[model samples]
Target chain A: MIASAYAVPSVLVFVTSALLILIGALGVISVRNPVHAALCLIMTLFGVAVAFVAQSADFLAAVQIIVYAGAIVVLFLFVIMFLGVDQRAHIHFEPLVGQRAFAGVGVAITVAGLIALMARSHWVTGAVSVSSKLSNGSGNVKELGTAVFTTYLFAFEATSALLVIAVVGAVLLARRERSTTSEEAPQ
Target chain B: MNVPAAWYLVLAALLFGIGAFGLLTRRSALIMFMCIELMLNAVNLTFVTFARTLSDISGQAIVFFVMVVAAAEVTVGLGIVVSVFRRRSSTSVDELSEMKG
Candidate 1:
């Protein structure tokens, strides 16, 4: 069993990640600027990655940081900047007009339903058996790699194919057609 | 103090609700994207909490796939935003109403 020294850091990591997540979620809604919203999203993504690490999913954490915070968000910022869209030119916020009431009622009913279901379910107190497969194995890159290649080979291949389709579709959609209007055409 | 998994689930639920509110109220495409990211992160938190409680690695594996799909989505979403901006010179969701089929 790991000592308290190891456990303390993990606890600290979880607390900080949860705090950051809440802060980021608030920032996402409160900020009016689009760039600032995207930056808040980056913070949220980083917090989530830390949470993953604390859960002993080191490989998943790395993937979260690299794929989400590193690549996807940067791409978003680049496109926002490239488009040169004015942040404040046409600001508009529609009046709630009964929608808020409807939303509140919907949320209340959903919460009531969830509470009733929780009251009825016995799974919360049921005996949980730790699977033998992961008993001794550390959730490191090595274990993940072996599992992905052997047990999850089909799923991995499917993901690759989906990625390929995404790339092709993005390329086709991103192509900008040149205007052929006779404004000194070919001059 | 040791926090229980239920606390994390409650936090995730709150974040999800906030994201949904933003999605409903916001008119900016970029803001909407941020809200979508919030929702995704909320789901990710739920995944992590379950993974911790069950002591299983499968939930983390699902999170890995979710992150991949999110990346692909952002790429495509930003591309569409750029194209919309090029045509209309704005990123407001209301302005795109004319382009609706």
Candidate 2:
């Protein structure tokens, strides 16, 4: 009786997020233009952020939007513009012989396997129900901060290191000049 | 009130499959990269769903790291893509098949 406040809104949020995610995913794959696909990817990222919010992981939702949509996708677009790779790619061509056929088979197998596994396992069952771990009577961001800095401190530090290395590597890779024009010629 | 958690899980699975299909079928380096991002997002959905179902906070925390790793991957990957495009002036995997020996 009293839970409807939570239930009804959650149901609405869930439906909206799900639809947006599916549509965006399809658009990303089916859209011919790279720019359009990037936009679709943004939609999908936003949809996922909504789903996170619905689940009460408010911190994650925010981070998802900031990091993924704001930074990552923007980086993708920057690279696309810089490389001029936004020109239409050979979407129809299968680089490897019979790869499309193989991909089709792989998709079927993966879908069937996932469905069967989920049906057989109790992992999805309502075991513990939703808890306030994210908020923990304080605030969403605070709980996340405590968990990350205290319990997952090592992992948090490791991520910082990894990010540093990745940034350096990206800069180095992007800065290197093509050695020889003749070497650039396709064999 | 009982939106079965399985529904979310199933949605994640479907999203993953779609992402995989895109990854396999698409040849554009950028589009393929976008497809990979789709797959990662699907995994994040699954994590959040389980975090809710199991009443655990670790899943969400893990999702944070996943986002971090994904950001790093995009940075490095796009750099490589840019380099390759500069060298060969093409992003098509078939056209960039220089190591097909």
Candidate 3:
């Protein structure tokens, strides 16, 4: 009874989040509407954040919700709305003649290989290593901040530079043609 | 509950496979982009699972970088998608076949 009581909550959370993730994942691929797909992606991201929390990775869980579910998916929806690409897609058509068939075979092979490899080897098994050094009996965010500012400082700074470049490039790519077209129109 | 960490890894693999399948089979560029996001999310799950198993903060830290890169990719990629749609009223990858030689 003691063990069963201990297991109940975690098991329930795990099963709930797992179902959410799987259903959202399938919806992402199977749904014809891009907007719906974006929503499904948000669901998947939330489910991942839940799983991260379950694993005690509080910082990661927060970032997953903030960056992924907050920023990235909203951008997807923005593009979809602006581009008006949310019209129902013709799901039956294939641009490449044998692409769909090849994809099916490749996916089957990949799943089979992964399952075989995972089942046959005990590669992922290991004692749960607590992040006690980093967390240090404090908040997980504090630990994550310390690590980012110390050992991973260079990488963290480099990511900022990369983000700046991406922003500039996106602006240039989106705006360059408009200026050029306007210039030609006045000609 | 003592959910084995291996189960998480298996779940991650399954999600990744589904993402790959969508990436290959879908023709809509937007949906394809969403599929790629799915793949990235799956990778994030894998990283967190390994982090939990190894008791390492580094894996979770790497997930931060991955999220940053993914955000950058989405911004730039969606810009390109919008430009393509502006030029041609369709976001279908098959329709953007102007490069066919």
Worst 10 contiguous positions by lDDT, candidate 3 chain B: B1-10
Interface RMSD of 3: 2.3
Expressed as tens digits, the lDDT of each residue in A1-187 for candidate 3 is 6446557766677777788888999999898888899999999888888888877778888888888889998899888888875565778777678887899899889888987887788747654544434453333677677778887899999999999999998987677466778888977
TM-score, one value per model: 0.82, 0.87, 0.90
Better of 2 and 3 by TM-score: 3
Mark the 10 consecutive residues where model 2 chain A has the least summed lDDT.
A130-139
Q: Identify the leading candidate in terms of DockQ.
A: 3
True-vs-predicted CA distance for residue A12, candidate 3, Å: 1.3
TM-score of each model's chain B: 0.94, 0.94, 0.94
Model 2 Cα lDDT, one tens digit per residue, A12-121: 88888889899999999988888888999999999999888877788888898899899988988887777764655656766589887898799979988998899898
Please give the DockQ score of every candidate, comma-separated: 0.46, 0.64, 0.65
Candidate 1 lDDT, tens digit per residue, A1-187?
3335345665677678878887887787778676777788888878888776666677888888888888877887887777764567333445546665576567556645654564467313433433212333355566556666766678778878878877777766676745534545869
The residue pairs in collision within model 1 are none
Candidate 2 local lDDT, residue A99 = 85
lDDT of each: 0.70, 0.82, 0.82
> Candidate 1, which segments miss by more than 4 Å at Cα?
A1-11, A89-92, A95-132, A135-138, A179-187, B99-101
Model 1: residue A32 alpha-carbon error in angstroms: 1.2
- Checking candidate 3 for backbone clashes, the offending pairs are A129-B55
Deviation of model 3 at B80, angstroms: 0.7
